[model samples]
Target: MSEDLIDEDEGPKKRVLSNSQVLGFVMRLWLRRPVLLAAAVGLMLVAIGFDLALPHAARMLVDAVTAGPANADAAWAAWALFVGVYLAFTVIRNIAFRFWNPLASRNMKELTDEAFKKVQSFSADWHADNFAGATVRKLTRAMWGYDQVSDAVVLWLGPAFLVLFGLSVMMILRWPAVGLFSLLAVTAYVATTLLMNKYYTRPANLKSVALDSRIGGALADAVSSNPTVRAFGAEAREEARIAEVSDAWRAAALKTWTRFMDVGLIQNVLLVILQAGLTGLLLRQWQAGRASPGDVAFAITSFMLMSGYLRNVGENIRMLQRGLDDVEDVANFARQAPQVRDVAGARPFAGELGEIVFDKVTFRYKSADEPIYQDFSLRIRPGERVALVGPTGAGKSTFVKLIQRLYDVQGGRILIDAQDIAHVDQGSLRRAIAVVPQDPALFHRTIAENIGYARPEATLAEIELAARRARAHEFIARLPRGYETLVGERGVKLSGGERQRVAIARAFLADAPILVLDEATSSLDVETERQVQAAMEELMVGRTTIVIAHRLSTIRSADRILVFDDGRIVEEGRHAELVGRGGAYARLHAVTQGAAE
Candidate 1:
């Protein structure tokens, strides 16, 4: 995450960003490409200068013809010069557009990359609350919005103003009254544009963008939850829910366009009246011999140019508002802070991980009232095989999470080999531990890719060896595509046992010194479980291991068993010792054993 994106006192709740701030953020990206943008703007102005000069040339031709045979040669020469300049700038305009577009595209790409990296750096809790679809939509729209705004401002709006400025100079030199009216018209148009955009167009555009985000989120939720909808035969209900969001989006779209068009109507009416009234007054001046025929020609041409300028200004203002909304969306995502961060001057873990100690650790979830662990302390010796046995909600999984620094403890500290875990780099600490979860999550990628995920550079032979050790190679070999078969999202295409085997294979490939098995074999049948248990035994050799035991039979050979109740250790001993004592572990073990029988 970049320092500029952070607010020292930022909270989980979103901060309302102002329009100037959002626009300023986007302009920073543009500032990085100053040379390219400046050249483009220069070329654009040259083109506008030509456009402004053409009208004066037309006026000169008109006055020369009115001057009769005396000015015929000068009139023909002026006409020829005008045609040549027009052709020259026609080529220049083409070149400028070609050069400018690529720079805008490059700027957009750079901004997208920065925004994506920022989003990935956010904490897990922030991601959990923010929908993936909405985030994706925001990113997509932000890049596109930058492109649209660049075109509206640099290519059209800026050039239009240049033409107006040049024309105002010519109008004043030719006729004072016309020049005064021209300046007033420009001021009125600008004021009206600013007023309409702020009061009506901008708010409507923001509402529409919010609706688009909601619609996208709803669609993503329904599609990802397809299995749930189909299992209950509620396809129609799901469709209706999506329809509800889509209808709202439609209404928002209608409202935005209606407001924009209504404002546009008033602006066009004002321009028409100004042009008509100005032309009539100029015509009378020409009839009275106070103004030349050329002055009347200049007046008509300038009015037409002003009309075009007004239209482009209105369009750009709307585009500018839409772009601002997109910038706000991406900026909000970038502002979220990662909950777990390395301490100052954090270094990489050194050498081997010999032991782990939870020293007076206290922890609680953000939403929970009571602490899950209150001053909890524990120590695990090097290469010890320990099993944690308890009912659900006993803080087994959370212990693993804290060990991995997925979340930090609220009080005290955890140490590994006498080094505090919080004082080391997060990536280094996580790389030392391997976890095989009960229900492993996989990407929509090939089977081999999933197996080699922990060690991406693993060779085919190494992957096969890991698969064989996990007792997964035989089934994989029989599949149509073997290791190349695509596992649907979350490995849904595979059976429960297959997914477990794949996860185990990934762990085998990882070969980390500290291993965690959270009911790793719970998903398999009795026969498959026995085979996997043998493989797990081999994998655990000479490694510090912690197992969250659901099936008591699997932990019989563990060197130590810690029985938990209500988030505290109730008993600690060998399985045989616990059973003989007839304590909480014994009663729980007996219940599990009887159920299996």
Candidate 2:
């Protein structure tokens, strides 16, 4: 396992990325096409500039109207020019928005795709530690949140700053009182939002985490425990459990909603106070002959514009907080170091796989305190059919996993063809081996597709040939759609025996030099097991076969049998020799024979 797989002792500290860091990461990917980003920013600036100029033009018109008849024509012409500039700004902004929005969407899609690939590349151990639904939610939420941030920066924030700055300049020019009022309103809005965020942000994040946990737990439970639920006729019980979780999620959502509503109320009250103060100041100025009706009208218009911008700023702040939380959640997964990463410059395995040697191998799952195997060693030569016989929890299955490199050993080296498997490219090593797990996991795809998954480019004839070799073609041909029949989720549509056959067919098609079968015929009836055993024997003829069997009859013809007890190999020999010796293997064989009788 890599060093990063172990959890740190710092406790959860709201693993957040700063706005600048987020922007930098986005730009690193987006700025590769500088022309697009530059054009988008340029058009936004032009739009803001034109939007800012309108308020000033309104103020100029007010001044001109108050000055006398000589300024009437100039005021009307100024209004017309303002209208023209505003329209041009709208057009340019729309054009720029059209170009930038799609690019941002595309960038988000690429990021999502890359994150998904990284998740798929993660070792099985990582999957065991994390929930699948939560990982998916994180990826989706991050992509969406990144898009919102982009929109806020380019569209919402840009326009808001333009309006605020313009109002400040105009207030200074014609009505200083209104300018101060607008600034105070902005300050109040910012303060209120910041305060609300301080109280609500953590809860909101906790709510999201709780909701994700509920979802992941429910999904995993429903799928994995369907058999138990059905057998016990507990559908209503399961539904009630789901409803309970759903209610909790809804209550959490309401808590967040209530906080948001409070923020909105506070903002509305602040806006009313600021507007009333500005209006009173304007009236006093008008009474003193310091301002005109037109000046009051301009101030009111600027306040309306600024008020709308300020409201959006408030909304964006809330979204920005949530976005950061989402991004952090997703980045956590993307940034996770794999537990079983290959060494630098790993090489591919070349030449025939001669012998697999386990040199004092030891392993333990991440959650376990004690190792499964301690100072254990085993060696099997090429073309050896070795049956590993052991009681439950004797580490037989773990041995198979170690050989496949699904998990790295904690101590000692595993050698394949006299070279350390750790030094081999993971892909090449996996390609050289095939495993038929005790519980075969099939995809939700067609029969042919599932078998062909091992070699996607295999011809239909090749698939049929492999199926025949695995004793699956006969049953497949009888299905309604034959090779095209969909297996449904986890091959639920097929019998356990049939699913095992499909798994065997996949292994047959893969044609790896090293094959591992973990109770491959355990699910089959006697007649079916006989047929599958024949096919398996033929397939194992020229390969290194590691068979884990509870039924000693299936492994009776093996060249060697290793009896395991408490993670150690207690006995090793052919079935006849072991039986003659009357050791662990003989006792195990007797127990199995008695059970069968």
Candidate 3:
């Protein structure tokens, strides 16, 4: 598997976000849990208040001491009050954080789960066009990113306001020069943090995108080429490819981290400058007799408070950048439009499906520009057994896809029971039809569970009966675990014939009015194919059956045979009549028979 499939190269692009827009997006999810948000906000405010009060308590202790040597009792009383108040605030802050962290984590988990559920509801075409690994990365990032928003709100914004409020109080009560110097230090710290962040944000975001692409590409390629890798004995080669991609990812990550550490270094330097300047100013004021020893102590306390708050502010800025990157990935996923969407006011289909009509229908794969089928038309009557026989790109699969409404026709309409399929709800349409593809895929589950997937609530007896009808029960019973035998991933534990039999059992269990077998029995040997074909004949007794097959012998008994060339049906009739006509069907039948000989 090529690494590019999972993680393609995407260049750095500036994300567009006004402050109001970003805030609005964040608030939308938070507001959904009003009580939790309110509680978090209240706790944050309480924490901030306690933090701000600590600096005031220190100032009070200083003022009491400065009243003169005879005021020793008052100083002792002030010291005791300050210690008690500070301890109470510390306890309160810890308690608030305990309440806040859990609420934030829970909300984030719920929001991500909701997004995943929405993704699952999309149709097959959506999955085909989008990489599964990329989607997983987006969901994971979204959940973890919400925590960054919480940190910014509670740790950064809250502490910043508290520090500013504390500084204001000190300026009023203490020496003016000391207070002025303390404010200047705060300004310098904020300025340096912001400037560093501006340089770091873009690179960090690009690194995230690159990492997502690398992981996604590796996973996609590994899964898509599992058979080839195993067959060619290229496991070592695949491992080397994965290692190369991992190395590229590590390089990108290190670049981002280095930039982030540089920002941290700059922040620390500014903090040192601020603390030293404040300390020097306070000592000068005390020497000049403009401030007492206790007043100088208060100035030191104020500097510590400012430093703690500014450090938190810097941390929050870093967190905010990470949160933005995560949200961008989520936004990219959420903004994806489903390749096929239901029409407005689409209603559920009711009653039996009659003639299915395709009028000038057209379609093409996502990577293809030209339509695979152009101006294609077909009318299949109720209970008609139609075999669509064609060469590999002759639009046989595309025709079946249109009938199931997996992808809407690009040029015209497909009608079921005289009503446009697009107007009916997809669930209802699919419920009336059953499909068994060429290579049947089974989930990693028990034999009974695989058969019961078409009808999850099917009883054990019902499953057994369906299996018997599909000639699969005899083989299933012989297994060590009987019906409970695990099928392994994609039914790799079973032979090709057994897997097709299981798929046939599923179709029998579905009991839908329309049955589609797209090379459904291609895997079976001659003897097994005969038995499975017999079972299919019985199951198709009262259903509209559409079979796509290359083997003419399997489809020879179909009520109507539609022979396709390129993207158009060149001939249509019964087996004997078509063979007698010496047209496309007859010529293909001759070729197949010759190959068999």
Q: Report the Cα lDDT for residue 31, model 3.
A: 74
Q: How does candidate 2 score on lDDT? A: 0.79
Clashes by residue pair, model 3: 6-216, 6-217, 7-213, 7-217
Highest-scoring model, lDDT: 1
Residues 291-369, candidate 1, lDDT per residue (tens digit)?
7888788788778877787788888877877887777777665555667888889999763755889999999988799
In terms of TM-score, how similar is model 3 to the real structure? Answer: 0.89
* Every model's TM-score: 0.91, 0.91, 0.89
For candidate 1, the per-residue lDDT at 485 reads: 94
- Regions of model 3 farther than 4 Å from truth: 1-7, 10-24, 62-80, 94-102, 121-126, 155-158, 161-184, 223-227, 364-367
User: Residues 405-439, candidate 2, lDDT per residue (tens digit)?
Assistant: 99999899999888899998888888788888778
Per-residue lDDT of 1-597 in model 3, one digit per residue for the tens?
A: 011223335322324443334445666777777776677677667766767677667877888888877999988988898897778767776776776777777778876887787687666756655566667776887787777866786657666856665675567456666666666666666777666666655556556555766577677677667889999999899989878878878878777778878888888888888778777887887788876677677667877877777777878877876775566555544555655777899999764855789888877776687888888888999999999998988888878778778887778889888879988888888878888888998999999999999999999999999999999999999999999999987898998889988989999999988999888777778898888888888888889999999988888889999988888889999999999999888899899999889
Question: Of models 1 and 3, which has the larger TM-score?
Answer: 1
TM-score of 2: 0.91
Error of 1 at 291 (Å): 3.1
Give me the runs in candidate 2 sitting further than 4 Å from their true place: 1-33, 60-76, 173-177, 223-227
